[model samples]
Every structure is written in C-alpha cells, then in structure tokens.
Target: MKIPFSLPVIDDEVIAEMMDTLTRTGWLTTGPKVRALEKEIQIFIGSSNPVLCVNSWTSGAMLMLRWFGVGPGDEVIIPAYTYSATALCAMNMGASVVMVDVKDDFTMDPEKLATAVTEKTKVIIPVDIGGYPCDYDAIRQVLARPEIRKKFRAEHVRQQQLGRILLLADAAHSLGAFYKGRAIGTVADITVYSLHSVKNITTGEGGAIALNLPSPFDNDKELVFLRALGLNGQNKSAFEKNQPGAWRYDIIDQGLKVNMPDLCASVGLAQMRRYRDRFLPERKRIFQFYLNAFSRYEWAILPPCRNDDATESSYHLFLLRLRGFDETERDRAIQQISSCEVGVNVHYIPMAMLTLFRNRGYQISDYPMTYSLFANEISLPIYNNLTEKQLQIVVDTVVDAYYSIAGTEKTNVV
Candidate 1:
C-alpha cells in the first residue's frame, strides 16, 4: 500500500464554504468574510486582543518587524533550528539576525538566549517546531532580567512604550497547541499562526497575527494601524470605500499589500468552526497511536507531545529520531521507507547549514544541538485523512527499515 506524507482535509464543508464565499459574498477581497474569520480565530484562540489575517506568515512577520522599527544595526534573536523564513523576515527588515541554538526538545534554549542578548536586540522569535510550544515562561524570564532590560535601547515609539525586547512567537505549526493550560495565541506578545496547506488548520494559503501586547500599547488602535499597512497604507479598505459618499480616503504610509482575501479566509473559517471538537482531537489521537506503537522500540526517539498538563502539542509533525544513528544512516533509513512506497521527510536543515545563511557568515558549528536534531530526525505522516491501514503500513515499514539498517534480528510483530 502506498501512503503520502500528509494530506489536507478539505471536506464537503470546506467546498461549500468556498462556493458560498465566491457566489454569495459580494465583497470578495479583504471584506466581511475576512473580518468574520478573524473574529472567529480570536474567539477560538481565546486571545483578548485583535487577530489580523494576512496573505501569508512571512508577510505578517515582516509587517510586525517593520512596525517594531527594526532596521540596520538592530538585532533579532531566533533559534537556528527553525525554518529560514523566521530569519529571512528579520533580514528583509534590514535587521541583523542573531541565531541561537535550540535545546534537545527542538525548542529555543532560554539559557543560550540569555547569553545572546545585547543592547541592539529588538525581537526574540521562539518557534514552536512540530506543534510543540516553547517554554515561553522561561524565555520571558530571560528577557525580563534587569540587565537584559537595561541593555535595551528603544528606537521607536512601540519599543519605548514596551521598554524591552519584543517576544514574537513563530507559531506556524502550533495553532491548536496549549502552554500552561492556555492557548498559544495568548502566551506571546504577538503570535503568528500559519494557514498554509501543511499546517494544523489550512486556509489554502493565509496567516493570522494575534496581537496581545501589554497595557499602554492600545491594541485596538494598533489593530487599525496594522490593517491599513496590510492594505497598501490606505486609510479605507475597498469595502469601506464602497459605502455611499465614503469614496474619499487617504494614504497613511508606505506599506505592504498583504491583506487576506475573503476567498482564502472562508476555507479556514469552515475548518476552525469544528476544529476543537473534530480536527484537533483527531490529530491528537493519531499522535497517541504513533506514540504507543513506537514506544516499545528503544531506538525510536519520540517527539515531544504532551510532556505535562501545562503543555500540549497541535500534533503537527511526528518527528521520530533514530538513536545512535548518524546523518548518513538516517538518510538511508528514509530511503528504505520510501522504497516501500511510504513517503517521509526531514523537518528541516538548520538555518546555518543552508547555502544562503552560510554565505552570510553563519556556521553550523555554532549551533551544535540544532545540527544534532537535524541529523537523526525524520518526520512521519500525520494528517486528518490518514486511515488505520495506512498507519499500520507506516509503522511496519519503519520498523522493517530500522531492523534492516541496523542488521539486527526482526522482533516478533506484536
């Protein structure tokens, strides 16, 4: 039997919603549907702040960095284990990217982050790789330290009002994840949730920014400003300008056109309506099934899911690590699994290992732990449409490949 790595669950509901958006909704781009989706997300994530939908995660992140006044000579701290987009967003804003190593669990190491802080640091972006939430409390503690706060030199009104570095969560893979019994959106000052095809919740292609800034920031006022920036700096959106006698508007500032269309927003809106009761629970069940199957094997190093009551994953990618295996062996194992018609993949190549960053003077040697995780990691199939038979095939194929590679005796099938 052949099985793909992942598949988006675009059911009849999603189709119907898309049709409704295209046919019934007169305002197609960045209109009522987009606003409704944003409101739904705010309610679902339990964030008391504004939730702004954008065209993509990268665009939302770029807007946030620009709003925070990141520019040349400024530094943005990020974990080296994350996708290149995390670093690229800051780089696009003319800010220097400061890479830090991650812990064994694949989240940013707060201790290493402490050492990397400097007076120029403007943002600390901790990625929730594979749906697992980072230790936000620990990272927050590091930023809140007197010396670290004292080192901060605010260069903009947003920076000066906060009086410290910003904590932006790259929660692309962690929309339904929970930290300390609370949803991910509220944990960070600004959490960016991806609506890409491979994410827990998909809008075909979109993203949302949960603005949970502290008091004196006026989140509502900031939301209006961000909405304008997303729409080519126009004071009035097309829908607003359509009102009778409201055609006159103003261009506030030079901003990026990254507004989310109502067409794309409709897809996610349909999925999120039943996400808590349907989608999320199904994903978590699959995670447990894999955990139960792989736990007996001493060589199968499971990815972090529910470590404690305080933290729970979105069940995005099930990254299984091979114990005592080097990079070559892991690659061979993936090939073996693929040979059996089961698709598999690696989570990512470390940012320092990428050619773009390497040319920019970054080195893999600087991030030892990040390299270690990348070497042995293999992301398995975990999607809502996966069938029981396909799951069994995946497990059997993986076990066979491991035994074949290790040249060990095959244990009896349980």
Candidate 2:
C-alpha cells in the first residue's frame, strides 16, 4: 500500500461538532462558528488581538498587501524556500517579488534578507518555511536601520501616503508553531496561518491572519474596519444583519469576499478543541518514532526540532535532509520510495529557480544556500491517523529506497 504524504486527521469529534454547528441558527458566510474559531485561535495562540479568519492564507496575503498599498512599483522580499503562494500573492497585487536565499536550516536568514531590499521595496513577506519560524527579530533589526527606515518610510508615504513599510509574514505552514516563547502569529506585523489539510491543524480548506500593524498603521476602529474589509467591505456581518434595521450597511473599501464560512470554521473549532488532547501529542510521538528509527542511518540529517534558543516549533513538517545527496539523487530517492509504495515530496524548488523568477533575471546560483537546502531535502509522511504498522511501513520503505537509490546493498541500509 502506498503511504501517502500528509492528510487531515479528521475524526468523529469533527463530525459531531460540525453536526452541532449545522443545527445552530445560521449557516451563512461569516457567522457564529467562524467567530468561535477565531476566538479559539486567538486564545490558543495567546494573541492579544483578534485574528481575521480568511478563506485562505493566500488571500490573507493579498488582503494585507493591498491594505499596505503594495503596487506595480513596489517589491516584497521573500525567501525562495517556500511554496509559490508566498510569491504569487505579491505578483497578484502587481508588486514584484525579490527572492532571497534561505539558511542551512531552511528558514529565512536575516543576513541574506538585508541584501535583498531596495529603494522600491514596500514589504518583506518572509515565510516560516516548513513550519519553522524565521528570525523575525533579527529581520526587524535590518529593517530598522536608519537608511532602510528612511527608504521604507519614503516608499510607503509615496505609495499610499502611509508611514510604515509592512512586515507581512507568510506563516501558512505554522499554525501552532512558536518563536521566542510566543506563537508565530505575533512575530511580524501581519502573520498568516493556514488550516489546509496538510497543515498541523486542519479546517479542511481555511486560513487565518493575525494583524499587528504598527502605529499610525491602525488603532481605534481600524481593526473593526479591517474586519469589514476582510468580508467584502460590508459594514455588517451576516449575523449582525439578522438584527432589525442592522441590514443597512456601507462598503467602506473595494474589498474582496474572502471571509471564512462557518462550515470550515466548525472543523477548525473541533481541531482546536482536540489539539491539546489528540493531534499535538500524537504528532510529537510519531516524530519521535521516526527520529529514533532514522538516527542510526549514516546518510540522514534530521530537521531541527527547535531552530535555536529563540524558537519552539509545532513540529508540523519534518524536513528530512538526506546527507551525501544531490538534486538528481534526491529525485531518484523519491522515485525509489514511490516504487516501494511510500510517497515522498520535495518541500520546494526555491523561488528563484522557478520560471517566473528565472525569466525575470533572478538566478538560482545567486541563492546557493536555498538551492543546497532544496537539493538534499525530502518531506516524510506525518499525520495523526497513521498507525505503528503504517509508520513501520514508511520506515522500511524509506531505508530500502535510500539504499537502492544511493547504490548501497540492503545490508548497508540504515
């Protein structure tokens, strides 16, 4: 049987909650369920601010970029070791993406980001690639330089007449991850978390954005105003409209309809409730099992449990970086695993290596670290539903595949 990559660990709890939600007064777009989910996320993450539940993290990126006034002449720096959605959102907003290299650890390196900024740069949407949060405080230091500060301020004022350059975070893979003893949602000016099936927490197909915009950026009714912007600029939510005469509303801005519906939020709410009970513990246990099994292997370079003293991640995506391997060999290893009925996938190709950036004169050779990280990495299957037998299947398949691809005998296999 082919062991799939990550899949949602849905259970009867989710079914029961969803059933209960269905019996609630409303099933419309942004209703009680979404509010409950958002509240749960805020509490779980310890976020002081209420999170904005969006349809997807990609749309959250768009909403933040648009709110920050990113346009054709603007640029947003991003690490190349992430999914295309991190970059596509910038392009979708008519802003160019400046792809930077990643560190050996696969997270965005602050030093590399320092070199990527330019006069036209309006935002830096660094991704917490593979559920590993980047050094956000260090990145903030680079952006805080008087020269950078001046340029950022001037560019923002010139673009939207605002005074601050946005530090939007693509934290899609890090819903429950942490940095510096705090959650990922509170690290940057705006942090987006995905609730996709493959993420640590699943809402089936949903995401949330936590806003922490700087001063003169938002206060008073700004967050409330922004809430409306997230829901098609409509002044009143569906639940609010149920009240007499509250149906009369105004569209403050030309916003997109990217609100999270209660159906998806119901799943998220259940996932949140069972997170501490089932998902979190099982995920850690599974990771520990794999770590123990693979530690004896000569060619294995396991991913960081904690990037360093400053962070403690949710252990969502375990990036297995095989030693003594190149990109071609890595692909060969993946193929071998598939043949053995154990599916494997590469985290990314690096943004600069892709056609979209390559055609724009962004060279893969420029980001050597990003390329090197990509060349050796493989993502193993991880989910709560996987059993001990299934894990053994994965372990055996991977070892056998590694031996076959690296041209070593079964006796030499780890």
Candidate 3:
C-alpha cells in the first residue's frame, strides 16, 4: 500500500465522545464540550480571555483582522511564502495586501518586513511556516518604530491609536511552538492556530484564536462574548437561554456563522489530551530522525527550531529543499519519490504566480527570494504514526530520486 501525505490519528476515545454527543442529543451548537476544549487550549497557551474557535484558519484570520479594525483601504503586510489563506483573509475584508518577500529559510525577514510597513499598514501577519517560528523580537522591534507608529495611528484611527502596529500572527503552523519559552499563542497581539486535519492536532476542520492584548478582563469574560460573535451575534447563547423558561436573547451585532460544533470540539478535546502528552514528543522524535538523516547533507538546510535562541517549532512539516536543482529537476525528483511510494508535495506557489495576484499586477519575479525558495521546496511527511520502515522508505526514495534525476553516482550523505 502507498503512504498517504497525512492522516488523522483517531483513537476510540474520539469515537466514543462522538457517539456520546449523538446519544445525549442536545448539542447542535457550541456546548459543554466546546467550552471544555476552549478551557484546555487557554490553559495550554496561558492567554487572556477572548480565545474563540472558528470554522477554519481563514475564518480566524479574518476575525482577527476585523478585531484589529482592518477594513477597506487598509493594507495588511503578509509573507509571500505562506498559504493563500494568509493573504486572502486580509483581502476578504477589502484590505489591500502588501506582499513581502521571505528569506531563503522561508520566514519573513524582519528587516525586509519593516521596509514594507507604511502609513497605510493596518496589521502584519507573519506566518510561522513549516512550523518554524518567525523572529518575534525582530518583528516587534520593527513594529515599535516611532515614525511608523505615528503614521499608522494618524492614518487609521485619525485619533486614538493603539500605539503600535498589531502583530497578528498566522501561527496556523505553530501550536505547541515556543519562542523564548513563550508559546505562539501569546507571542503576537493575536495568534490563530489551525486545527485542520493535517496539523499537529485535528478537530476534523477547525481553528482557534488566542489574544495577547492588554488585559484587565482576563476573567474568561471575553470568551463568553466571543461565542456571540460567531453564533448570530445574539446576546444570549443557547446555553444561556436554558434558564427557567426565560429563553430570551438580543442581536448585539451582525456576525457570521463560523462557530466550532461540539462534534468537532470533541475531536479537538481528545487531541488536546494527547498533544503535550503523546503527539508532540512522537513528532519530535520523527523530526530528530529527519534532522539526523539530512544533517550531513550540506545542500539540505534544516528548518529552524529557534530563531537566534528564542523559538521552538511544533515540527509540523518537514520542508526539504534541493540546493542545486532547477525547477524541472525538483518536480522530477518529487515525481520520482512518489513513484518510489513516498507522497511529496510543494509548500506553495507564490500568490503572485496565481491569476489573482497577477490580475493585481503583482510580480513573482520581483520577489526573487520568494520564487527561489519555492522553486526548490518539497514537503515531506512528518506525522506521528510515520513508521521506521516508512521513514527508511522515505529517505531511500529521496536519495534514489535525486540520483535518478541528477544521474550522479551515490555520494556521501553530504
């Protein structure tokens, strides 16, 4: 049988919970299970109130933008090396995207990012791609610039500004990831985590947001209100209306339908139980195995676990790059590896390469480093259950595929 790219590891616990939710027959919305899952995530991240689940990472992304007050004519800075959803979230809110190039490491270079920030920049979404954390200190330093701060404040609010550009993180890749022992959750003003099936944990299809703003209301007050925003902006949620026939509610604001169902939340809660205790360490071991295999190969650049001594990735995706391979050779090697029964995939094509960015007149060639990195990148499977024999097959396939395409004799691992 051929190996798939990724799969959710579901135990009987998840199944049992799903059956329980069904048999109990009251949960069609965010209920006790969802609330419990939210608490679990909050305890894990140690964030203030306002942690909320959305239908997907994109929903969380847009919601964060909305909270930061990004709307028409506002521009949000985003890395070119990320999934389209990262930029699209800003675009969905009618915000123009200031696409910035990434370093060869596939992270936004903080220096380059600062240069892109202008008076119109409403937010900056730095992605922790391939599970490697971006340099938070560098990003924060850039956002702290006085002139930039004044311009953003004067232009956006025209009066009472938030004092700095919001560092909204697309930490969809980093869940357990740490920077200076601080988890990704509280690193930025707001960080959204993807609990998509392929992520470190699966909620079937879901995401969560964690806030790091100034807090006097850390009493889990914001979390209760946040649910109202997703479930029709009603003042009273279903559970709240369950009191002694006083089932009345009010529409406070016009919101969207993107809440996590108990069905999905049940899966997340189960995964959360295993994330720190089981899944992460297993993934770490697999990451170490890949590092050991690829370390001697000078052409192989390992993803950063920490940036200048301040980050630890979730080790979500192992992105391998070929040093001297051209585009055709890289694609051929991927094909060869697939033929060898290892399913390989590309991280992304720059947004500019697609019709949407092209229509906007954005040029991929202009972002030299972004194009260069994309040209050689291939995503290798790094999930928990990927076995030793499977890993050997993966390693051997990559080696043979490279040699088959390059037509070179077996060289040392380097």
lDDT of each: 0.92, 0.80, 0.81
Q: Write down the TM-score of every candidate.
A: 0.98, 0.93, 0.94
Q: Candidate 2 at 350: error in angstroms?
A: 2.1
Taking the candidates one at a time, how many backbone clashes does each contain?
0, 0, 0
Best by TM-score: 1
- Show where candidate 3 strays beyond 4 Å: 48-50, 154-161, 215-221, 307-310
CA RMSD of all predictions: 1.3, 2.2, 2.1
Candidate 1 wrongly placed segments (more than 4 Å): 411-414
Better by TM-score, candidate 3 or 1: 1
lDDT of 2 by residue, 217-307 (tens): 5533556876788878888887788788887888888887788888888888888977866787788788888889888887888887674
Model 3, CA-based lDDT: 0.81
In model 2, state the lDDT of residue 222. 59
Q: Which wins on TM-score, candidate 2 or candidate 3?
A: 3
lDDT for model 1, on a 0 to 1 scale?
Answer: 0.92
1 or 3, greater by lDDT? 1
Model 2 pairs whose backbones collide: none
